[model samples]
Target: MSLTRKRKKELKRLRSGAEDLWTQQQEVLANANALAAEARKQAAYYTREEIAPRVRGGYDQYVRPAADTAKATAGRYVGQARERVVTDVIPAVGTAVGTALSVVDHARAARSAAFAGEFKKAGKELTKKTKAATQNSGPGAGSVIAIGLGIIAAVGLLYAVWQTFRADDELWVADEEPAAPASGTTQQ
Candidate 1:
């Protein structure tokens, strides 16, 4: 079989048409992809560098002054607190430590003196004081005095209350003398 020239020409024309359609589609898709990439880059740049800075101004305009003032006040307070620790607290701690050291030193001295038999004068003075205390306050004198005072106060308070509420015309008393018993008594 031999091919005809008219059919070959027609086949060529159909192939050219298909290739044209494909080429047009390729151009459109390439342009769309390029435009999309450019759009993405522009959006990222706007958000990161341009629009982001403007939008972030809200904090600087509205909140920064108050935050700065608060920070400065807090700094001043920290300085004052440090000063107080250095001046007042440190001195108080030092005084307490000094007092403790002095107390220990005094106790050691007193113990050494007592052991060396050099505290005779002090011992005699202490003995006299202890003897005087024992004589004046025998056994539990403060407690006894306190108890006696409490009882007297209670009786005085009772008497005052009774006198305040009692009738003026009547008196409550007891006889000091008692009648002697009879030697022998008989009753029917």
Candidate 2:
């Protein structure tokens, strides 16, 4: 078969899109991790500057290796699917998700460790704020306000942590399988 002009154009676009998507995926993961570190810093958990290098190294070591494996696996799957075999993108997405999950676990552990190591007075600032809110409203409003604040803080932290691994879904997907052969084509 001969290559057509339109086919060549489509192939070029596909290749470009694939490259762009990979670069975009890396950028997204980096931003998410950076934001998570920033969240910890803004909360006075610790100096996030010190964490960036370690996080970058983790990406280089763990994520890069996992992603490389996933790419190879994905290419093999695509080869199989192109043979008219019914294959899915699960391997690609699964590898990416597994890597992200690993990172999430590490980040959570680091966060807890940081919180534990810091022996700074806890709840004193919160207590002051709670008291201030109570004065503005009523006497019994303090505990309720404190609980609400606690819930909000918990949710915010969860969100920040979640962001650290949210790029997995965007990283990889399975290719479409080849179409079935015609039934009337019985001759080999």
| Each model's total of backbone clashes | 0, 0
Tell me the lDDT of model 1 at 95. 54
Where does candidate 1 clash, by residue pair? none
Q: Which ten residues in a row have the lowest lDDT in candidate 2?
A: 118-127
Give the Cα-based TM-score of candidate 2 against the true structure.
Answer: 0.22
Q: lDDT tens string, model 1, 109-157?
A: 6567678887975465556545544663343433454556679999999
Distance from true position, residue 164, model 2, in Å? 60
**Off by more than 4 A, model 1:** 1-36, 48-50, 121-188
Report every candidate's CA lDDT: 0.75, 0.68
- Scored by TM-score, the top model is 1
Backbone collision tally, model 1: 0
- State residue 126's C-alpha deviation in candidate 1, in Å: 10
lDDT of 2 at 107: 54
Error of 2 at 176 (Å): 50
